[model samples]
Target: MGGRRRHARPASADDLLSQLGRLTARVREEIEVQRARVELAEALQRGMLPSTLPTAPGLRVAARYAPARSGLDIGGDWYDGFRLSDGTLAFSVGDVQGHDVEAAAYMGQVRIVLRAVAAMGAADPGEILRTTNDLLVATDNPLFATCLFLRFDPRTWTVRTSRAGHTGAVWARADGMCGVIEHAEEEIGLPLAVMAGEAYPVTEYRFTQPGALALLTDGVVEGPRFPLEEGLAAVARVLRDGVAEEPETLADRVMEVAECTGHSDDAAVLVLSHDGPEACQTAGAAPGIV
Candidate 1:
């Protein structure tokens, strides 16, 4: 029997318990590190967005951005509004292709490039988007993004918009009629970075009445359990029925409805309200309308 000297029962049960405790501690430490990384990613993504919406006389601007629910994957949905060097009020909403840190980083790069291009006096939204696409392609950025870019002339209540495979924007007239801006087959250009020289056409919409234009990411319309049409119809209904009196209020109310109905993706909405003739008289240079 002494020959076997049975292997000391694989350490005592207490020793095994101690080893298990160490393993558990290691796992907890790793989990904490992961949590910290996620928090940092979220903060960086938020920093990519506008700290404050730019002020444009005669135009009331409001925007909302909601990330996916806690513990869910992060996303790259962004909204931006600013006054260009030439006094053109530019607004944009975009969604990058993925729900990860890479997508978020790409979004930041795209947004920065777009802003830079706009600042360089790229008057046409279509041209701005085209240049952005070219830049992305040149950089070998593999990610694609859908974006709606609008250039608004507060003086004339005129809007020039370009779409790059993005959701159509909804316009609510002063008379309460809400409808989507129709884009011809050719007008809906390919998403950015899809082709080296993709061309986006500019579509013009004049606000004849004191209404608002709503620019949003697909996440706002495509709910978990509904088709795209259904989601768009829901949004149209919300606009038609009158959700809130102010642009910000309306944005909040619409997002609340979407969330209540199980919208799981990230959602962003930017509402720009035209004050009609009464408000257009505010001081501003008559910038070149696209």
Candidate 2:
């Protein structure tokens, strides 16, 4: 018993090799699967966004979209320039919860249906919400969405807007005053896809000629280190920073400011500046530049 002998089974080299080979194959397949999932996810997110923004006569619209840190967090941020059959221009900005394919797909569906509802000459933000809600109530997993809908009738430079669960809008007049239109008393209305029968009332806010209104998601107003108020002040400060005039330049300035300030969330901003007949000839001025 002093020296015990250990019994051992003969090793099977070929069997071990086969096992290693199978493991490698399995890993390769898994990688491929992951790659495909990413590709599909990107496609879905891209699909949710507009392939090309629509053009509406007598209206100048500019938008900037930023996906969350990863492309996958793309979520449901979207901007639509709706052209009604009656010659009205409708614009909306919305955010859905997920960046997955389903969110992207539903985002597309919501935009189409909502645009139709808003185009019915019912320029009510609340009405658009209600009608869109009716259609989505049928969806079992109906996703949730927050939107700010604005409609402008070239007949009048005045624009009417309604907000859902989204952030309130800031209108900085040509005279240099900044006012936040609290989401209508109706701003508290539930988002679409939740309660189908819920009644949403539209609170109307009018912009005088030569006024500018900004419609945006929380991502814009809730940037790093700043609550809604700070983010908004930043926006106004940047807008009045003495430099951007072209519609595109204004949009770019806001986006860059948000990004530079460490706004990690997907930031999207849609700014509409209405220049009365006087400023129309040269809309390219930069008190709004970055």
Clashes of each: 0, 5
Q: Which clashing pairs does model 1 show? A: none
- lDDT per residue for candidate 1 within 60-160, as digits (tens), equals 87888888665536688999988887777899999999877888888898899999999999989999999999998898877899999999876667789
lDDT of 1: 0.80
In order, what lDDT does every prediction score? 0.80, 0.67
Q: Which 10 successive residues of model 2 have the least lDDT summed?
A: 281-290
Q: Identify the runs in model 2 with alpha carbons over 4 angstroms from their true place.
A: 1-36, 51-58, 184-186, 242-244, 277-290
| Candidate 1 lowest-lDDT run of ten | 281-290
Q: For residues 105-131, what per-residue lDDT tens digits would candidate 2 score against the true structure?
A: 777888888977776666666678888
